[model samples]
Every structure is written in C-alpha cells, then in structure tokens.
Target: MVERGEPVRLCLHIGMPKTGTSLIQSVLQGLRPQLAHEGVWLPPNNLAAHRIAVEAFAADSRLSTRADVEAIREAITFEEAVAHSRPTSEEFTKVILSSEYFQQCSVPLLLPLLEKMGFSSEATSVVAALRRQDRILVSGFNQDVKAMHRSTPLIWDPDDAHQLDWYALLTPWAETFGKDAIKVQVFDREVAKKESLTCLFLEACDVSYDEASVTSLEVSRRDQENASLPADLLAFKFVANGVTRPGEVDWLIDEAQARGVGGGVYGLAEETVQAILEHYRMSNRQVALEYLGEDGDLFDDVVTAPTHTDLTVDPVILSSLLAICVAAQPRAEGARNHHLR
Candidate 1:
C-alpha cells in the first residue's frame, strides 16, 4: 500500500497481441492470491487481464455492449479502486489494467478516459511486450483461422496488409506517458532467458516475486492455451473452415490437440518471413533507439523456416473432417425443417 501521501501508480499493459498474452495472463491469475498479499491488486473474480472492462470503455466499435458495461457494475473505470487509492490505501500501492484492445487504441481516444478515472500522467505507466513482426503475423493468421474468422489462406502480399510498426505503436504512448514511464520488453529475448513470461511482466510493473508463494501455480508447455494449430493442417483447416459452423471450429481444434501436433508449427516460407521483417525494418530501428534506448535492432533477425511449402494433411484428420460433414447433414436438414415450421 502507498504511504500517507502517495499517488497510487497505475500500470497499463497494452498487449500487441499474439505475443504469449494468454499465457502471461494465465500465470498472473494463478499467482493472484500471492500478489494480493503484496499490495498488488489484480482485482478479484478473474478480472486480472481485464479485457471485458477495457472493451467496455474505449469505443472503436468497442467490443462490450451497454448491458455488459452495466453488468460489471462500473468495474471498467476501476471506480472503487481509484477512490480507495487516493492519498493512501491500506490495500494496494499499484493497480494493473491490461488488454490487447488497448494496443489498437489511440492516445486521443484513451487519454480522456484515464483522466476521467482520476489517474494522472505522472502516476501512470505503459508497458508493451513485443515479438518479431513476422512471427506475430503468422501466429495471428493461425488464430484467426482457429476462430473461424474466414476460410481464406494467408496471402503473401506484404503490400496488401503489413506487419506492425513498433515505432508507430509505442512513440505515441511514450510521448503521452513520458519516455521513462513507457516500458518495452522484447518477448523473444525474455522467453529465451526465463520460463515464465508472467514473471517478466510483473518485473516490468516493478512487482517482486522472488519471496512470493507460488507452490500452487504451475506452468508447463502442455497447459499453454491458445496455441496455434499444427502447421501441416493449415490447408485442411482452410478447406474445413468453409463448411463448418463457427462453434464447430473448437471441436476441430480439440481433435488437432489430441493428435499432439503442438503449436508454433511453421506455416510460412523463410522468404516470406524475411520479407515481412524487411517491411518493418526501419520502424523497428526507430523503436529500438527511442523506446528501448538501444542502438541495436529491436529484435534478433532470425527466421524459423517452414518445414514444407506444399501443404499436406494427416489422413486420419482428413477422414475425420469428412465424417463430421456426413454427421451434420441430417442435423442441418432437421434445423431447416424446424425453421420452416
């Protein structure tokens, strides 16, 4: 908790997406009780990452509806927490709000919201965890497919839609939150050193975990959620996506997982990977000098080459998709009849 006269520090972690965010959030949630004892509040009732709260407040066709906003009872603004943090709170010295949506948000849209919430620029900080542009693109495309957003495969046209510009993304935040208040950590580098992205995130927020109790929290590769589908099935999934309902995608994903093909499966060529990074080369350099204060590149220029350019699917999975279609035909007809009635 803050002393007799200290402003509670507010930390906003704007996720750039597809950068192990789900995994990071999972770790923080697992250690929530320990963090609470240390005066670090993640909020009770599984509100740590706070996606719904963030979605409710900032409008860019904001995700949450008015009903959702009201249902949460104004947790979007952290009303009670903000009020309690005034002068001093015997409760918490720091508050963290995180969401991938914030990364897509602009300063003009967000500044007013923060001011209304009683957090000043001086007491607030922004933390961004970045991954390689090419990696993010590939991983994100897979996620989109898994979610049944579309059936089309990723087209290799850098000009059509490009990778994220780190400089463009962070410079605004740095200018608004102060250069010192903006914390940038390379996701690839940190993952290489430590097993837990959560620990790295908390460290960026200035929360110590060395002495904390984490006997209950566990992390293993097996349990990491939102993993990309196996690379070999990319083409098969693209085809199945055309015929399957959105909800059916989960069953397909579960079957893929059961096969244990694992995620981070390569789905792009080495040349495509290089081209994607090249598109963002200069912007990344500016971010390195300005945000990270480093003279070198923002991330290591490395590419994991795809195993095969020609797409192939396991016969078993292909057969399963056929069976699913066959099984659904009667259900579809029955639903049509019901609708007609």
Candidate 2:
C-alpha cells in the first residue's frame, strides 16, 4: 500500500507459464481504466518486465550457469514490456510483472535481486498457479512445439519426468520469497470451464470482475499451422542456425496438417492425461498438499479434448488455394536450415 506521500511499492507477479497468465494479463491490459479506478493500475504499454527480469537475472554474477542466463534472458525479454509502462498516480498502485517461465527460477538468483529492487520478503508476493505436474509438462511440450511450428508428437520418457515436478518449480520461489509471502493457488479446469476462475483470480488481486464478459480468456499458443509435426519430423528437429526462417516452419505445419501425419499433438489422449495426474500424485503428493491446500481436489479430474483432424483445405475456396500456393513457395529460407543443433 502506498501512502499519500510514499512511492508505490511494486508487486511482481512472476508466472509459471501456461497457467492462464496470458488470459489474465490480456484482460488486465484491456481493462486498464477499470483497474485504475480500483487503485490497481495495469500499464497498457509497459509489457517488457519479463524480459527485464530475465536479463537482470542473466547478468547477475552470483549465478554461474549459462543455462540460467539463457532462461533469464528469455523471461526478461517477454516480461520487460509489461513493467516499463506503469500508470502515473499519487496513490499507491500495484505494478505487476508476470511470466510463466519463473517456475524454474533459482532462489540464489531471485532473492538478492528482489532485495535490490526494493521487494523485501514482506513486500513481495510471489504468485504461482499450479496445475498437476504431469499435465503442465505435456502442455509445456505442446506449447514449445507450437512456438517452433514442429509437427512431431512430443514423447515423454518416464525417467525424465522429474523435469516436470511442481515442487521443483515452487520450492525456489518459496524459499526466496519466504513461505508466508508466496500466494500459491491450484488451478481448477472446471472453474475455468464455468468461467468463474478468472473472476476469482481478479478478486484475489482486489480488482472488480464486472467486465469479465468483455475480457477475453483466450489461451495464447503458436499459430494453428505450428502445433503439430509430420511422420518425417526428425528433419526439422535440427535446422541450420541462420537458414531456418519461421515462415518455413509454418509452411511445414501446414503441409503436415494437410497430410494428416500426426495425432493429438495439440491435444493429448484422455488416458495419457490421467496417467500424468496419477504420476504427479504418486511423485509429488507432499508438494501438492503443501501448495494446493489439503482440501483441494482440482487435480482429480484430467482435462482433455479430442484430437484435431481438420487438415484439409476447403474445396471450393479459391482464396484459400491461392494462399496455400503463396505459402508453399520458399520464403528466402528452406530445408537447408532445419536443425535443432
């Protein structure tokens, strides 16, 4: 809370990605006026806080790992835009910096930085909304593929499942922010289905939910042409560094969709979803109970949709054919650049 004469204390909302951050941020960004009226100023153009945070973390000398720097840079680039466009006001207004990548933040890198930024353990509220670990991982994999326009289905090895642990995501933030300062919530897909979850989240932020209908809850992912891979997915796995253009990736996604080469890359099987939940339950029961509360049953039900199969172009649409023809031709970059390494 800002006193009449005191500078407003910043409240950072570090996200764990894929947990509805895009929808919430989009809604808040759209309702800037409404938010300001309630003492919550959502900056319309200051959207780079994520990038700033990442760059800040990457530049920190305390952490020696290159992976940490790379991750920090990505998060900082995405978040910095949100932090720089704060609303002007005499009253204390909450300035939020949100991104989903912070789930992997290291405490040593996060703690001292928060202190340096005037966010004390008491002033900082490290917020994270967790889904069941298994589901989060699968969704993350799909999201990764979507961003790169890869058509192959992401296969999981049970041995590598530790990468998706919810506890691992939370423990660092909790340790750095202090357990009491962290407000961790478990996501209920059913509540999202009922359209009540957004309101609940806004309410937690002390913002009104009257404009929920006008606010879009659309999930952000890569364009439709980038979500799945074909049977020949390995060729695109390691594109040559400078030659692989993003447009070529979209073209590949379109071609794979046209040929119907993969199943449910965007959507996972029901059993597979359930198995993930079970795996999380077996692996991270303590973490779930600690973060989600003992009574929370949101993880019991697995959420899924049927495999998408609409890969064909409309037969009678001339414009669609023309668009495809234009897309099919190489756009300065092609197969020569396709390599992950």
Assess the local accuracy of residue 88 in candidate 1 as a C-alpha lDDT between 0 and 100: 39
Candidate 2 lDDT, 1-341, residue by residue in tens: 22254444455565655666666666556666766776765555423554445544444445435553456555444334433434455553565656544544455666675555434565566666767665566556555544543445456566777767766666776776666656666665534566544565665555555654533433322121123343133223223112565454555555545755443334456667677777666445666567656644446564656443222323333344345557666752465456422
Q: RMSDs, each prediction?
A: 5.3, 7.8
Best prediction by TM-score: 1
Q: What lDDT does candidate 1 reach at residue 337?
A: 100
- The global C-alpha lDDT for each of the candidates, from Candidate 1 onward, is 0.67, 0.53
Candidate 1 clashes: the total is 0
Q: For candidate 1, lDDT tens digit of each residue in 1-341?
A: 33436666788888777777766666666776777777876655334234333533545444455443444445534555444323235577777776676776567657776666556789888889888887787778877777645677676776654337777778778888888899888888876775566767788899978523332343443265576767656656666678876666666556556755433365578878787778887888887888778897888887766765544566766776667667668988999999999
For each candidate in turn, the TM-score is: 0.78, 0.65
> Could you tally the backbone clashes for each prediction?
0, 37
| Ten-residue stretch with the least lDDT total in model 1 | 213-222
Candidate 1's C-alpha lDDT? 0.67
